[model samples]
Target: MRAPLPLDAVLGLASDLIRAPSQGGIDTPVAVLEVGARALGALGLAPRLLDDENGQPVALMAEIEGGKPGPTWVLNACIDTAPAGDRGAWSLDPFAGVVKDGWLWGRGSADSKIAVASFCHLAAELAKSKDSWHGKLIVLFDADEHTGRFGGIKRFIKERRDIGGVMVGYPENDIVNIGARGFWRAKIEVYGTAQHSGAVSPVPKNATVKLARLIQAIDAVTPPPPPEGAPFPLPPKLTVTGVEGGSGFAMVPNAASLNLDFRLTPAFQAPVAQKLIEGIVAKLDAEIPSERPTKIAALESWGAYKLPADSQLGTALVAGASLAAGRPVPGEVCGPSNIGNYLADLGIPATCGFGVTCKGVHGADERIEIASIPLVWDAYGHALEKLLIG
Candidate 1:
C-alpha cells in the first residue's frame, strides 16, 4: 500500500502547477493536466483526458468507486488562469511559483490552481481510505472556463456520466455560491455623411455624435437591482467598454461604433435586453435623417441562472462547506459563470465558489494566499468526504 500523502505533498503539487504559465489565450495547460493525471493514477484512479475540437487542453475526469453504492459527486476545478499583466507590479516572477512567508505567489496560485491542486490531493487521499461510501466520486478539471466558451466542461458532460451533484472550487473565500448573473455583449453602429470641416453640406451630420447619443440611450436603460424576493442581490447593469469613430482629425467620419457589455440578473431575459438595445438604435435612427441609418449588432449572449436554495446539491454543499470551514456558510450569487449556466441549463444540482483571496486574478502579481492553501485543501477534502463519501 502506498504511504498516505501529506499536506506538504499537496502543496508541492500545487506549487508545480502554479509554476506552469497556463494563462488563457496562451500557454496550454497540458502539462498541468499531465501532472494531475499522474497524481490520480498513483491513487489507483484512472483519469481520462478530454480535449477541445482544436486539441487544446481542456479538462481531466477521474473516477473513484466506493465499496457500496451512493450519490455520485462531481468536484470540478478550472485549470486555466488569466494572463499575468505588467511584470513590474510583482515582487517575484508571476510564473516563478515562489513561496515566501507562508504565501504562494504566482499567476494561477489563487484564482484556480490552488483549488485544482487541493482537490487532487483530497481525491488521492480519499481513494486510499478504508471508509467506504455508497457512491462514486468524480473529479473534473477544465481549461476553457476562463474564456466562457464552454469547451472544456461541455465536452466532459457529453460523456453521459450520471452526475448527482457538482462542487466547483472557484475562489469564493469559503462561501457557498448558489448561482450567478448572466452576460450579453453588443455593438452599436451609427452612420452619417462624411464632409470636409471647411465645407458645410446641406445635410452635415457627425456619426460620432450619433454614436454618442446611442451610447447614452443604452446607458439610460441600466437594469435595477434584484427585487426583495429575488435570489440574487445585484441588478442588471450596462457598460460601454469601447468606442471608435473618425478616421482622421479633419474628417467628419461617416460611421462610428460603440461596444456595450451588459450583466443580466436572473429576472432579465436576453431577448428583452436585445429588444431594448434595438429600441435605442431605432430611436437614434429616427433622430437622424433617412440618409443615415443606425444599427445594433449583438456580439454574444449568455443567460442568467439561479440554482434553487432547496436544491439537493446546494443544501449539501452549504452543509459540507459550513462543516469544513467551521462556520455557517453564507450563500451568495455571483456574476455569470459557464459552470452555473451549464448546471442550471442541464438541471444538474451544482454550486461553485471556493479558493483563496487572489488580489490580481487577471492582472499583474496574480497570487493566492499561501497560508490559505492548506485550509482550502482541508475544507475541500472534508466537504467532499461529507457530501460524496457519505
Candidate 2:
C-alpha cells in the first residue's frame, strides 16, 4: 500500500538516542532529544522542547497539519529511561546503541527510544504525502516519564485541549493495550509502647511485632473478582511493598510503617479498596490494642478505565495491527497502569502498549527486534490512514 518506512534512518536515529544518557530523576540532557528534533527539523517540520514548571525541558513536540481539517492525534513515546542497573551484567555496553543479530541493543531501546525514532520518521512520511490523510499528527516525546511524576505528559494535556486521541508507543507488538488497571497506594503507621528489652513484666508492645501482625492481616485479604463481563479480567491484588521502622535490638521500637499498593479492577474501585483496607486496619486496631491506633494515609489513586468496543481510536488501531499481523490482534487491557490512565482521568481517549517486540525491558541487556520495526510502522501508519482519511 504505502512505501516501506525509513528503516535505516529510524535505526540510525534510535541508535543516537540510545547512546545518549537521558535517565529520569537526573535532568534529561537536551542534547539527547535534539537528535530527534533535528531529524524532524530536516523533514520541514518545526520541533521544539517543552519544559516543566521549573523550566526544565521535559518533552519534545513536532506537528504536521494535513491538507484538510480533521481531529488531531498524538503519537507519543518517552525519551527518558529507567536507571540502567548493574552495568557489569550487560553483555553489550548499555549505551552503545549496538545493532547486531537483527536487534537494536541498549537502555531505552525497547521501553521506548525506538518508537520515538519511528514516529518521527512516520510523521515525515505523512508530511511528504499530505493528501493521503487529514487532521494533525503531533509527535510527542516525553522526557520525564520514568521518574513516575509524568510531568511532561501533564503539561501537554493541560496545554493542548484540542487533542482528540493519543497513541502511546510502549513496546509490545502482539497485543494492543486499549486500557489498563488502576492503582491505589498508601502508607500505614503502627504505634506501640517503646520499652527496654530487659523489662519482662509489662512485656512491651514491640512496633515491629505489631507491624508484622498488620502485614499478616493485609496479606490475608482476597479482593473480589471483576464483574462477569468486565472488559479487563484481571482481579484486584494487594501488595505490601515496603516495611520500615525499628533500630538497634537493645530497645523496643515505638513506631513502624509499611507501604501498601492495590491494583484495582472495575468491580473493586479505589474508594472500595480504601474502605476494605481501612476496615482491616480497624479490625487490627481493636483486636490488638496498642499505645496508638494504626493510621492509613492514601498517597495516590487512579481508577481503572477501558475504551468502548466501538471506540474510533481502538478500532482503527486493532484493525491496523491485525492487518500488519495477517491475523487477529486483540485489543486487550494491560495489567499495569500507564500514561493512558492519566489521560482517562482527563477525559481524553488513549491507546497504549503497541509497538515492536522487546526483550529485557527495564532489565539488563534491553533490546528490540530490528525486523519488527516495519510491522510497528505499518500498523500505526495504517491506523492513521483510517482515522485521518476515512
In terms of lDDT, the best-performing candidate is 2
Error of 1 at 123 (Å): 0.9
Q: Tens-digit lDDT track for model 1 on 81-148?
A: 87777788888898888878767788887768777777776777777653567678888888777765
lDDT tens string, model 2, 1-390? 467887888999999999888888765658778887888898788998888888988889998888888889999999989988899999899999999899999999998999999998888886777766678889999988999888889888778978889999999877999999899999999998887888777777888898999999999988888778767788999999999998887778999999999998777889999999899989888988886899999998888888999899999999999998898999999888989988988888999879999899999999999989989999999998888888
Using Cα atoms with residue i matched to residue i, what is each candidate's TM-score against the true structure?
A: 0.88, 0.95
Clash pairs (backbone) in predicted model 2: none
Give the Cα-based TM-score of candidate 2 against the true structure: 0.95
Which 10 consecutive residues of model 1 have the lowest summed lDDT?
1-10
Question: Candidate 2: worst 10 consecutive residues by lDDT?
Answer: 125-134
lDDT of each: 0.75, 0.89
Question: Any runs in candidate 1 off by more than 4 Å, and if so which?
Answer: 1-5, 129-131, 194-204, 245-251, 289-292, 336-338
**Cα RMSD to native, each candidate?**
3.0, 1.8
